[model samples]
Target: MKKVSKVFYITVVLVILAVAFGAAFPDQFEEITGNIKTFVATNFGWYYMLLMSAMVIFSIIIALSPYGKIRLGKDHERPDFSTATWIAMLFSAGMGIGLVFYGAAEPLFHYAVDAPTSEEGTGAAFKEGLSYAYFHWGLHVWAMYAITALALAFFQFRKEEPGLISATLKPLFGNKMNGPLGVLIDVLAVFATVFGVATSLGFGAVQINGGLNHLFGIEIGFTAQFMIILVVTILFLASAWSGLSKGIKYLSNTNMVLAVILLIVVLIVGPTLLILNMFTETFGLYLQHILEMSFRTAPLEGDNRSWLDGWTIFYWAWWISWAPFVGMFIARVSRGRTIREFITGVLIIPTLFVSVWFAAFGTTAGDVQNSGIDLTQYKTELVLFNMFDNLPLSLILSIIAILLIASFFITSADSATFVLGMQSTNGSLTPPNNVKVAWGVAQSAVALILLYVGGLTAIQNTIIIAALPFSFVMILMVIALFKALSKEVKSGK
Candidate 1:
């Protein structure tokens, strides 16, 4: 079994290296991209979207149900963190630089192009925009996280399954995973995690570079990427080596506090009234037209299909890819908690925060644009920087902005590193210091490579392209989750 798992891991690494490096140094990256485009278009296309929608609804029902009351893991002992701290951890680890990266741009992009829901008169685009962000970021994504987390937490902590995606898949594959099947699951999970973390690292480097440029008027190059990666890696490794109590816990708390401060500032300093209105209306629109929006293909009439492919499908795939890491992390933190509580806290609260965040940041940008502010000259990463630039007290606000961006990036890197470690370590259940540090360094390296290859666009394109295989895996996971739950309930376990 060990030999099989090792082979699987080594093979996956080789294949991924071949593909990533092949594309990186290829005669044609476009050809590789074209193949990826074809796969997403044909395979996941509409079925993938519909399946994800079903999974979201089903997971939410489970989250809200009474039978979902079972706590995962054998320990049944509560962790040291309070409810508030746990919430903070969830938000910090799952969100990371997303809020910093998309807060301003997503809402405006939705307003300008309009969400799929907005095509009809029933759902206004702006309102649906926030809802869509919430939906993608919200319960469903967390449900994916929970599926693996719950499995790991319960099995490793309690039932003593190894702390790996393969262990979770064991209930289905049985001892087969002890053979070749186990290797397959773990290998897929590791590759997915590496690329996912790399994507985050790549984006973080670009965003950090952009923030520096905005503040100091410096040109970004290898020097900038290397410096950012080095700093981020060191911070995360230091935190990891310090142990969860000192490092992860401290960083997560800082991240949540800084995040709340940024949100409050945006609410108070930006067009507060407009953001509020957009939030209320947009949420209603999302609720009303969710079914249509979730399944909308926008076939052939326009490249509406392509747009869905780019955003909704792409986001779903990305989330799916990250599930192994995020799920394991959630599992570690969640013990002695009922399934219902875990789901609500993990899935519901974070999603709500994402909605408000998009509304607050994105809608502000839209309002400014609508009122004839030409902030378009600023790139997406720099959108928030530009908005903060307009503040009456620019210097103080800029400093705050820098802190906010740093907090987002560090928290994200830290969490991803921890997760990758947990997954790799055969499910130690609780995070070990060495595992965390190794993942942190690995993630930073990927970020450096992506930066050396190109910029943010290249990273984003890579994530989308890499998402193809994982999309299928995610669909299987959804099915497996439902089956496992049903079996457990029926057996009265």
Candidate 2:
């Protein structure tokens, strides 16, 4: 039964891939993606936001309630990792590359072109810009992670049904959610994660290459992507083989350190004053315009800026698609944490950290652009190089950039591989280490294929396609979560 189900899922994914690749020409891809963006914004925009908001609120309630206990098992054992370390590792694993890639640039770009929620005028424009990033990185995004993670931890550790999304939904559908429905959910998550992280991989690879090129004066080419993937595969496979006790724990710890160093460097080098000021204002603007902004799916009108349509709308979809993987990772790491704690850790902490990074790095990038640096002439591979070109001690900065990009990529890839393995193995919540290694290698191969084929577009399209079904599953997941919570409370778990 499982074999048949897996084959059916694979067939469906292939059909979807064919459709995406069939539109590989630049114009065709844009047109199709554009139409998708419009459809999402027009019809499903509010639904997505509302869904995210409810998850966030429930997470907050869980954290505050004494009921949502993080346990190693149903019996409640010792702490796995320190709270601080666990939170850092979780954040690094959860959002890693995308957070870095999108943080500063997203808000700044929104400010320049205006998001859907923005009113006319510079003041409103800046407010709208900052708000978009906040929403993308804010409570809603974390809530998605919280719900998935909490569901997994509760179901797998507590109920012991193999720890997949299908297993999590078993509460609602009883046995029916098994078989095909269960397989469908798991497959959908795999596809979403592949595409989602592939985009991150593409972006990180390009940036990592640019950093290396700038540092060593090497010509930019496919060599960097190849090397980056090679390094990622090696590091993750080693960790996966070593098991979570030795591998994931150590990798997560090291990755956290590298992230801290990068943040400190950005703070020291970038415009401290501007970032501080902008962060305060941006946070305020985000808070002030939170509701209006959350549902504002930039309408496809004659008056809309193509740039806004390209960046903001695309980002929203991208984040939504990536939510499952990121959320699942966060949930995995958040054992023993209350719902409130999980939500706060996933939502608040990361947002604060990302806001700082964006403010510092984004302000610097904006300054470079404003100073007539003209980064637009460069391809994506030159993005980091272009940014560091104007900063002090270009060589040292380039080195730091390379290290940062590498670590982020490695950590994220490893985490995703682990999560994918867990999702697929159909065993315990924390699957056997060998299963983790298997998925990690599969992810690397997928990353290689994506880079080899159509670069970032193919990867991003794949993730989006994966999300289509999962998003609906998520809607059902949300309903199932409430039902489970109610049952627990009534029975007093």
Candidate 3:
């Protein structure tokens, strides 16, 4: 068997053992994972904040530096897809269902509870809520993705290396990257990718179930979530089988159009002026307070520290956990772009789009609540639908929202399956169909098992714990990338 196959089998066995154990001992699994998650968040919350800050700084510095001129591929080469297609794919693969999941809910949560810096339900809290929402989903998260994707693209396209995380770190260990150490790194990458994507899949399942429940009066439970996952698993695997250009790209474009329509409709039908003012004001606040918010930790907040850990720290860890999958997918699609173009596009375009999305949905939800609708009483998964209740064509818009979610879900899972196939198969650009199918099933199985074990809480804990080691790994990748870049510069390549 190939080394990739050996790694694949070993990973499969390990995941199976974990799932079996979790299924057999659900309460114990949640307790143990929950405790570990708390310990890490409590002790290392500062570390996550500092690390994210550094990544954001690094991404900007590199983009503005002389290295900005460097192309990810040969100088004469250009991008494979159109700019529009590329951005759509980037948004779809990176944060699809997540944006939909939190667009309204996150801001409302912050407004209802208020941050350490603001008072609840007041204008101050409202502005702070929108600012925090942008902060969580802003440049910091994409900077993480930019750094990882830059490293992978640099090594793969510039040096003609395999597109694997371990492969990108060849400067650190040299030949050892081809030995047992390399295998171990690849295994860890696979582990992180599976869990991170599974977490998203879990979130998508729950939200999809919630949408159905809101629309058709279906009961919300594990069975419905599992069924949703099963249907989506089939859709995404079929898309994966159809390959990247045909299935993934088409769905990404379609979803992007759908998302834009939804955003425009909400802005027109909802409080247009309030959302516009909220976005303009909150965006300015985000710019002015970016540094302070980026580094804000539980240590500084005194009594309000728990909120920082539960929301900000958790988001940081979740974004880092997703770095491997999103970064790899970005690199795969961004082969022929310059470093400046890649970093600027990834960091700017999507962040701005998310800001607008949050402004439309989040501020609108806040407006509805202030008008006495009280959307906060609903479950987080159903908050978006509940907000839709007060809008024009509620049922039609709800169905459109459901379709958008499903498309995003399919695109995300399809991209994940493709990336996981490459990671497990020695970075083959076109991995075998069987490998893709196996990984698709494995990802769903993990999501289902975690759903049964402890639902969203368990899923969040799993991602936080999985991200810790990979955070260290990403730091090394940054080092290795710079080391290699220095050599290339000296050699005048």
lDDT of 3 by residue, 389-427 (tens): 998878877888899989998998899888888888888
Q: Pick the candidate with the highest lDDT.
A: 3
Ranking by lDDT: 3, 1, 2
| Tens-digit lDDT track of model 2 for 49-113 | 56666666777776776545544246554446788778777777667777666655565565554
CA RMSD (A), model 2: 3.8
Q: Among all windows of ten consecutive residues in candidate 3, which has the lowest summed lDDT?
A: 1-10
Better structure of 1 and 3 per lDDT: 3
TM-score of each: 0.90, 0.86, 0.98
Off by over 4 Å in 1: 1-31, 64-66, 74-76, 113-125, 430-435, 476-487, 490-493
State the local distance difference test value for candidate 2: 0.65
Clashing pairs in 1: 72-154, 73-154, 73-158, 74-157, 74-158, 127-282, 163-426, 163-427, 177-182
TM-score of candidate 2 against the unseen true structure:
0.86
**Order by TM-score, highest first:** 3, 1, 2
Comparison by TM-score, 2 against 3, better one: 3
Q: Give candidate 2 regions above 4 Å deviation.
A: 1-46, 61-75, 112-128, 300-309, 429-434
Against the unseen true structure, what C-alpha lDDT does each candidate score? 0.68, 0.65, 0.90
The RMSD of every model to the true structure, in order and in angstroms, is 3.2, 3.8, 1.3
